[model samples]
Target: MAISEPASDQRRAFVLDLPQRLVCLLDGASASHGRASLLLVVVALVAFLPGFFQISPIDRDEARFAQATKQMVESGNFVEIRFHTQARNKKPVGIHWLQAASVTAGEAVIGPSALTSIWLYRLPSLLAAVGAVLLTYWTALVFLSRRGALLAGLLMASCVLLGVEARLAKTDAVLLLTIIACFGALARAYVRPRAERTGDFRLAFIFWTAMAAGILVKGPMTPLFVGLAIVALAVVERSGSVLRPLRPLVGLVWCLLLVLPWFVAIWFATKGAFYQHAVGVDMLGKVTEGQEGHWGPPGTYFLAVWGTFWPSVVLAAMAAPFAWRARRDEKVRFLLCWLVPTWLLFEIAATKLPHYVLPLYPALAILGVMAIERGALARAGSRLAGLVWLWPVLAILVSLGLGGAYLWFGSGFGLAAWPLLALAIALLWMAARAFPRVGPEGAVLTAIAGALVLYTAVYQAMLPQMRALWISERLAAVVKEQGCPAANVSSFPYQEPSLVFLVGTDINYVLPNEAAALMKKGGCSLAFMDERFTGNFEKHAAAHGLKYHAVATISGFVYNGGRLTAITVYRSDDAPAGSGAAR
Candidate 1:
């Protein structure tokens, strides 16, 4: 009852032909830089925009970054960094300045109400992610065929980590764009012969300027990634000749010129506390041990890349043989030098975040496509043939995992996601079946079809519907619906940065007794008392003679504590005891 071999072969050919045509179409498009660049921008937007406007402010990092930016917008303070009364001394002011500019532009063009829209804060990240894709293509062009470069950009546009970074208002996405810009210029200069490398001033400007921008965004990281690559290449080739093209001495002074003003300003502003915290504590502490519980052993990124890099990660694995054989090639060695040393350093570092190695992903995508170009990819009977299943199998597993999350946390199966889910899986299955005829390169293009669809489903459909996971959003909505949008709230036990961001800056993070005291003073006062503090709140309320009761209860998972939390919001309309003043 099985299908005939000829019939199956025909089916495989039809499936393979589509990806083949896609590859050809991109190659033709690459003939026109405008056409290719526009295509990459479109791809990046499609990959990044599905949940950009819909998802709530993520806690810990994204919300903290956004709130600090908001404070900058309000206070008109461009240099000093703060989160409420506490100084956010960890990072430089570049991102906050960019985010402030974004919010200001939104308010000016879109309306004053744009100040509160979370998407406005994330606009920089989305644009930066798109810029990184284009830069990836530009960087790959120095070594790869135009088609291969386009493919690399497409892979970056479709990556899981980039998409995540694009949606959040943080430094990583912007940092990524700068890093790739550095790579684009450095890769160009590195692959040339030492004798011909007379240091083009333009390339040096781009490299050092990009490095400066990276420093302003995140201290030390840009130099660390770029410097490590420079050092590694010098050590590997046993010569400092390659460094000539970058014009090291003059470029260093130019880089310092761009960054020193801010460093000097911040030093004077914080009395040197900024460097002590940003360098001595935040940076080094992360190297020695995990800060904020983001700890992982070595090789964590190797496993995380399967999901983080998605479709192209499988192809990158398939390209290992080619990478080994071509390790000595000028371009290949440059890429490996760019990728390996920093990667190993991060692996050795005690602090490990998934995005820590994101700047290196462009190298992986280029290598994968290079393998495909050289016909070194997996064939039907090849040793890497088993990896043909990795893409499709991972696609299915990740889809099921996300769909399960939607069902488990959202109180029901996400019915709206059914069509998209089926489409994604069906395309992946087709890609898997075509592997024998099309090979890894074509198969990656086909698998990306599924990945793009899955991204849409996960972000636009499933993630937005998981309301319980976004507790701060619910709290904000309830307060607004109760006609107290500007109510002063005292939140206890569940003081996530997202709550501080969504509810307002004035909200006090306090214990039950203090929350009760705050509510006793005036009208339009609110308290989000955790269930654990219910008794204490009631005791304090009785003592203060404050007539307040829980209007609504919110239940959700708190990411920081990794536990389910239940908080009851208490509202009050009482005036002060003696004044009888109505609010």
Candidate 2:
């Protein structure tokens, strides 16, 4: 009986230990999951919050897209998109469709005036930005550990180019989303091949479908990037057999089906005018001869842009050798394939823009994270620590110098921005003090975040006050007071489409030759002209027998040099006897 009693007590002890062990494991798993979820939420908030204050008005190509989408919605023509009285079929129909759909949905939910809402147009981009964050997180997880994924997300969310593009109503964000999605799917196909084997064809089909979506959103560059990366990865791994499951015929069929209808409709509707411009000029000529106004030096343009766009991540790029060393590791291999090929391709392109290289940013973020994880940044600690201390001392001296300069040269130096400068100094001091204790990684992140915050507070917060002091938002109100038809208003040399968008009018551009014809057609008009163009504009206006009276002038300062410029409005001398020919 004593032996049995002892055995029973031992069994009870083992059972008690089992439950406690299970509880510990469960608690650990929960903590990890919670941390990951919190990190993702923080990333999303960081990406979205800054845009709330920044207004992206119709500018350049954005104007073209907004005008086209507006026209399409009004015309109820889903297939063909038009802008500035011309069929613009160069870009695929995907973006226009998205805009139109948003406008429709917004109108239904928010009532009319939806078409004119910038937020409606910007909604898709905002959603795409969120998608980009989620995709970056998932992609990093696929190639790397949880910590790696968190770092990648942090890098991507902090990137300025991604932040800027995500705020604008453009195709780039959507293209990025699709590109990341396709790559994520490809990663899944590679990592979990056994699971994909049953539905391997379907998985490949979906991946290619995303590629097609990307192509439709941007152009051939989408497929080009995806294909190059995949092929390069396969070659590097010496595993062409991995690509055998991809169904080229099904992908082609899907792409043709998705893209053909719009192309055919555009061809018929424009009576082949679309073909000449879309195929011959916009698509083919852009690649061959380059666009008329937009051109760049062949090499290093992309590199410079990448450096500026994501300065923090670009700093990590110096650690590429460590990244290369880890190339045999699957995660590193994936990142290399994702980053290197796209970067090389863009670097080689003749036509380059800062935004064109946006697709490569996520891959670079991943690379940057990998580089950091591999201890590639440890070599810079001595220098980094020195800078952390040196930076604050230098900043304080610079701040004093700037204060002296401002006092000597100017008046009314407000204390509003001073607080930010002070805060920056404090952050620098704190970072310097914390460096030895927190280590290089924490110190670097702190410094980067401090710099970003200082920039945001100055540029975003201070600039608005300076702008308001210079340009009159009251111009729209004054124009309305003049009884000028909003549609009849025009600007010479340059166009302020923001005014047109706000006033719900078709703002006409008056070149030197057309000003006379336009004046004669519309007897009286309101116009705004930049002072820089005043000399040639006055000569042209005098030649056309037009009289003008200046109404209001607003002087605004440019931040770069604090130079002041004036925007002046004038009423036309000759009011058109009747409505001038439609602009």
Candidate 3:
């Protein structure tokens, strides 16, 4: 049944239409409609690379999570999270579970030291960020064109705030991804009306389940955000009918089933100490008291996000108008509901941090993509006219500014200096060559990603040298080498949990008043002192009749004001005396 070629006259007509067919194929390739999923994977990889390379271990909240997880793995205690030998019931166990899994897996492959590396601590967050990026792209595509979807992916990938979060071991990324997945599922359910009722039900159930998981990760705020967004979307769309398919009874059961086990276990184990700390202090008190020394003005967060999430900020701004214009549109309304409420809620809170607003980023990215697409079509003529002339002028100015910064502040013209200078020059050249054809949006985006990647790469390359200047790790190593039991060592004035985690020990703070009393009962005691606390130590130790000799002065790689002071470890004179040596 082979088909014969057409007659000569018919063949001539077919050949005449071949140009249109070829143009259609080219358009399809350019839009990359079939490969959108692949693009999302690529963007996620890009978002993850910086986090992978940057391994400057921070002794903050992330260190606490890692420590808790490590203890969980070793002790086989998965129900309650502990930090520095105390039941840390303030947060939920979702992040701990992820960290524990990463530690366990990494140990199997790379052995136990993986627990100490920044990568193991940060891997969960990085993976969650990747998931968030994929969800963001798919969510955007639900309502937007293919190009808009790509733009949204770009926005998420280039967001500095998200990038920073990806590199830290924190629950925020987990919370963010869970919320996003929920919303994405909901959006999908809404978009396809003829799609099976079962599909919608499944998606809704999954959304609620993810919310429950998020609750386990960061507590009630997860549901609070998800609930608010859903309510707002329902109100805007006048879609009272949309809620029916969610199957509230089944969904509620699912959520409770997923979340209650941990609560019950922790409640029984800690005899309600977990409940009080988690519900009373962690949730209510944290919001009202603004604990952990976190304080900010009402509008501070709005400004902070703007600075940290630059370039993405430009897209967010563009997206705002489109979101408003499409307020009646269900998809846009959903994104607006998610973005506006979450943003306002965080902004009004007494305790505000930059990462608190991460939930809104995906929504904002969607809006940005919409705005860019609309702008591109609306100003196509003007874009073509001005883009060619504007790029070279901007490139030259950027080049000069970069060169000036290096000449003024960087290590005055050495091998290190030249590489940075060369990078700057390359970026400038790229801007000049790419801007005319690609237009402002593409040019700006490419430049931002390039610049950030370059900066992150340089920072990561220098981190080992930078970390050597911090004595916390080295001091902790010394304590471990001496076979200091995990429970005995206490920090004075402040706590460096990272050190405790590194040394596989517990560290308690010696309150200003209790310092002397603790020193009197101490065994082979180690006390850390900096310039700020040297006076306090002298004043307290003299009052208590406790004598101390410096057992070690761990010099940090970085020095402040020609004084090589970071952390100094002291041994009590009561113990068998050892020589004070700098590590």
**Please, what is the TM-score per model?**
0.95, 0.77, 0.78
Candidate 1 per-residue C-alpha lDDT over 1-583 given as tens digits, one digit per residue, 9 for 90 to 100: 8766797677767787877876677767788888889899988898899989999999889999999998888888788898966999999999988999899989988886676689999999999999999999999998888888888999999999999999999999999999999889888887787789887899999999999999999988998998899899889889987767888899999999999998999999999999999989999999999988889999998889988988778788888788999898888899999999999999999998999999999999999888888878743156776776776788778877877778778746778787898888888887777777766656677888788898898899889889889999988877666655444678888888888788777778888889898888877778888889888899999999989766788888886788888888888856222211111
Candidate with the larger lDDT of 1 and 3: 1
- Scanning candidate 2 in windows of ten residues, the lowest lDDT window is 574-583
Can you write out model 2's per-residue Cα lDDT over 374-446, one digit (the tens) per residue?
A: 6666654554345446536645765576555444433356466578668767665655555555444454455
Better of 1 and 2 by TM-score: 1
Clashing pairs in 2: 521-580, 522-576, 523-574, 523-575, 523-576, 524-575, 524-576
**Could you tell which candidate, 1 or 2, scores higher by lDDT?**
1
Best of the candidates, lDDT: 1
Q: Which ranges in model 1 have alpha carbons more than 4 Å from their true place?
A: 1-10, 378-381, 485-487, 575-583
Cα lDDT tens digits for candidate 3, 1-583: 9987669656544433333343343234337745655655665576556436445556677778888888888789899788865888788888989888888888999997776776787888888887887778777878777666766766687677777788888888888889888888777766666335343577767788888989899988778887888787677666644554666678888899989988889889899998798889777765676766676767877788655665466446544555677687766677778878877877777787788888888887787667656664244444343333333343345446644544433333424533653553455345434444454454445545444544443344333334444456676776765545545555653455677677664565665336555656667666766656767776787888888776666555332233445556666666665555766
**After superposition on all CA atoms, what RMSD does each candidate show versus the true structure?**
3.7, 10.7, 9.2
Candidate 2 lands at a TM-score of: 0.77
> Which regions in candidate 3 have their CA more than 4 angstroms from the true location?
1-35, 51-54, 193-199, 376-437, 480-490, 507-527, 531-551, 555-566, 571-583
